[model samples]
Target: MRGRGHRAGRAARKRRQKQESVVQSVSLCHELQYVRLMKFLHQRGFTSTLLQPALFTDTGRGLQAVKSIKPGQLLISLPESCLLTTSTVLDSYLGHYIKSWKPRPSPLLALCVFLVCERHLGEASDWFPYIDVLPAAYTCPAYFTDDVVAVLPSGARRRASEQREAVRELHSLNQNFFRSLQPLLSQPVDEVLTCEALRWAWCSVNTRSVFMSHPSNDSLSGQDVYALAPFLDLLNHRPDVQVKASFNDVTRCYEIRSVSGTLRYQQAFINYGSHDTQRLMLEYGFVAPCNPNSVVYVDADLLCDVLRGDRSLDQKIKFLKENNFLHNLTVSSEGAGWRLMTALRLLSLPQTLYHLWKAVLLGQVLCEEREEWSVQTAKTLCQRLLQDSHTALDKITNLLRQCDQPVREQLDVVESLRQEERCILGSCLELLEGPPRQPDELLSCAPDVDAVS
Candidate 1:
């Protein structure tokens, strides 16, 4: 019996060791690929002396600073030849096929097709080293399961569905174009340029591309703004990072300069522009922790629900819609946004002073009574939103415990968004709890507090 127990313990230890070995192997494989990609970039006159590809605990994969970087220093640059663009597509073997095709493909389609085709070429492709490092799958909502997307906040879910549909429609719309390339392909173009394949390429373009503008290629219609900068695309985004990125004609390279220095061994970041959690998740498939620009949107349905009790509901709704105050209502760390305040004021206006509607929008305060009503309406709406936030959080916690990585990643992003919304609502709710403020009364910004607990 003792011998049997000892044997079981040894077997368990062996299993643990085997799992650890596999993890190490995978990590080492990633490092080798990154090394090859770096070598590939260096050969093409693009180089990064201060940064190396690394797996960040918080941000997954990002470029890490190997040496302390000084402010206003050129961090990294990619030569014009390294940029994967419509111009690049036009120069590839597909050049004549694209040039003579009727109803020319859009600039975006040209890039997406190039990505999918090159990926199928394996090591035979010139861009193989760079392509090998690209993500096998993306976490963008476009790839999300219906169950996962259903868990997103209302505004995010709506946009996610629209994006998913657009990608599918894009694949459908370009069936003829994908078919047109069959004769030029080494293999069947349909098999290589599938819906799933196009989805992957589309996401890569959407998330990893740098805004690049060059002389428009006559082969494609639409603006040529997309450029896949190999090593430069690996830099992660942080809302607070200061940097200047531009195509320098003198150097003939796309250069990124840091305004604020990065510390040695720290993950380097660039600003993706002041995007909130919603845009971050919808467009980029990640959530920024403690995003100062984060805000909780009050969609039209919620606003309508808020104003349902008013006697002039239809009139007020029509007025708000006509004046463009019907949507984009939001609450942020800094009290209510101007649009929300404006809509609330219109709803709270007395029937007698209806002509002042336009005036109210221009920042005119009607009366103390109307101000009180707006404040109360905002408070009530916030309470409902706060409750919805709590419920959404609970749902996410349950989902997290039941899922695996990848799906777990998507759920985690949605959870971050809900948490941010909770904090934003908490800030807004606390403001409303104070003395009755004016219709146009904007409160001083407050520190974020998570009310989920």
Candidate 2:
């Protein structure tokens, strides 16, 4: 009995030891991947010692400052040889075969095909190190399942639907193109150009590419509109930080300089222009909390609904469409933009005064007492927005409450977006409901009619 008990304890110890070895092997493999990627970048002229990758609980993988980086200092400089541009695809090993194919692929499409080809080549591909690190999936709303997309706010849902359609079209195109190339290549077309693979490549280009004009002497005309920069693409986005990125011809390098200094161990960020949350989420698959550029889109259909009872509604809609003032009605932190206000004013106008309102918008005339009507129209619009926003918020809140466990992160994103909309709507309501001012006082506070037009 004593010997049997000792044998059981020995078996447990061996199992524990084996498990530890497996864990260490996996950790070592990840470290090796990191090292290989870094080594590849170094060989390609990324010699900056100040920046290194670090994992963060909130942001996943991002570049961290290994030492204090000063303002105006060059952080990264990749020579033209390293950029993955249209020219690179055209000059690649696969390009020779694709040249004879009828109906030439656009630069963007060519890049997607190039990525697919390289991926199939596996370890033999020159870009294997870079391709290995590409994200396996994206969180962009366009990739969401239909059921998940249906619950989004109306404007977001519409945008997501549009994006999904675009992807579907691209997949069809890729399928046909790949079929034609199958006989010319060793690998099967279906293996290289699956819908999922095409989407991964397309999004990799969409999310990480930068725009730059090609060298003047190159055969490509105009500009190389999109080029994928390997290491440079790892820098995450922040709306507040300003970065100066440009290709320096003299230096023959794509250089990035920081306008805002970063302290040691701090994450460095770049501004991808002043994009609203919806645009960011659609393209980048991430949202910045408290983004200054966030805006809530108020659909033009809502305004049409508001003016449904107005007898002149059809005429107003006609006038708006003719004058090209019919779209992009939105509300932001600063309140509604002039386009929304103008649409509302046009809807509120009587049929007899449609031509006169057109003249006003064209800056042909100014009415002295127009403030009262404008103010009233703005208040009505604000009230309608508030009601709609509250209803959407309540629906989202109820959905969240019904979940028995923690909701998915995507749902959390939807809730955050709706909350922002509600907050902005409340602000608009507060401003519209403030004590009424005399017509002349309100007109004095308003922007110049010509400038607004």
Candidate 3:
């Protein structure tokens, strides 16, 4: 019996040893993967690893002269202090969660990779934060892609492999960022409502800025958090996008409108390219996703000019398009019809069909208003579809419209916009067929920018 007990103890010891070995092997593999990811991030101008301080910090006098460098240059130099703050914060968070990181692989690396594996090239920037502006957010410098290739040792035979791997890493990082936010989006509204710290929840994803509706309790409603989309973000945009949470009497669902869509379209025309943009306009009809009726409009003179071999703006426009840059070129005093249409259509929204109606109504009214104003002013109005205060005002107007309260109640909320001293109404009156019924109607309906002042 004693001999039998001894044999059983030996068998148990052997099994335990085998399990430990497997664990060790798995841990080593994970560590190696983590190291490789870190190196790639460092090479791409992401994190300056404390492990390899020499890789990022600049030493030579030439480096000192160029105090401020472009993102492409920074990646090449691997400067430590110049890196984004988020990286350090994340590093600390990971360290606390992952003890004995020495030989252990970082779990975050796997999480990042899993999330970003499906991301497009445009999304690489956000995932790898080390890369310059996201392709979706802003045009990354054309040279940055080149700089990444240059980082590999000269005549490296595996250049393609290196690039592919780097791209994969970037994608993973982006996916992780979104994944982190997913929980917040998925949580029950009541649970999310428990925390009412935010005065507003402005989500700028893709090209659309989705503003959440706050109830009297100032908590997020049941609206699903919108994720950023690639094609949608590439569309032309302006700051005046907003929504009012009021149910449309015509249709039961919530309604949204582009308060400044008219001005946006007006400005869009002024900035519309006189050359290729004109051609693109004619070839591709303006598709207003908001306007279901598709009120067709185009500039004949502009089309005629493009057809006559006016390709002056082609090269410039092609370059901007390649770099993801936005420019302004007004085709006529009235506005660029195709440009306005494309801008409206390319804005793919995830909102319900009801919201689309509100969008269409907003577009028609704004377009009509802009056409009249531009004709009277004999001036083109345009801006590089940037998200700024002007856009915020437009968003505010739409939100007020969506409120469940009466128009007067809505007006009270939007009174601040009306208080603006611009001559928005005066400009619209000039385009109107006749004088407005009353000055207030002109302000409320047509709206003069100056009356608010």
For candidate 2, write residues 1-453 as lDDT tens digits. Answer: 000001011111121111232211011114665677777877877776877766543444667787899998887787777788887887887576457555656666778888988888888888887787776556566556664576666787898888777777887865666887676456788877877787767777877787676644233333347778876776777789998988898998888899988988777777788888777767766565568888777676776776566665676788788877777777776776667766665554555455556545643322434444555656666677667667765765666566522234445555556666677767766766676444332212233322212
Give the clashing residue pairs of candidate 2, or none. Answer: none
Instruction: Look at candidate 1 and give me any clashing residue pairs.
Output: none
Ranking by lDDT: 1, 2, 3
Error of 3 at 415 (Å): 4.8
Model 2 score (lDDT): 0.65
lDDT per residue as tens, model 1, 1-453:
000001011111121111232211012225677788878887888766788776544555667788999999888888988888887888888888889887888888888889999998889899998788777767678888787888787888899999999889989998988888887678887789999999988888887888877676667888878888887887877788999998899998998999999988887889888887798778877766767888989888888776665566777678778888877789887788888988887776545556767777778765665566677778888888889889988887787788766676667667777877888999988988887653455322222221000
RMSD score of candidate 3 (Å): 28.2
Off by over 4 Å in 2: 1-30, 183-187, 215-223, 358-409, 437-453
Candidate 1: list runs displaced more than 4 Å.
1-30, 438-453
Please list the Cα RMSD from the true structure of every candidate, rounded to 1 decimal place.
9.7, 11.2, 28.2
The C-alpha TM-scores of every prediction are 0.88, 0.81, 0.18
Q: For this target, which candidate reaches the highest lDDT against the unseen true structure?
A: 1
Ranking by TM-score: 1, 2, 3
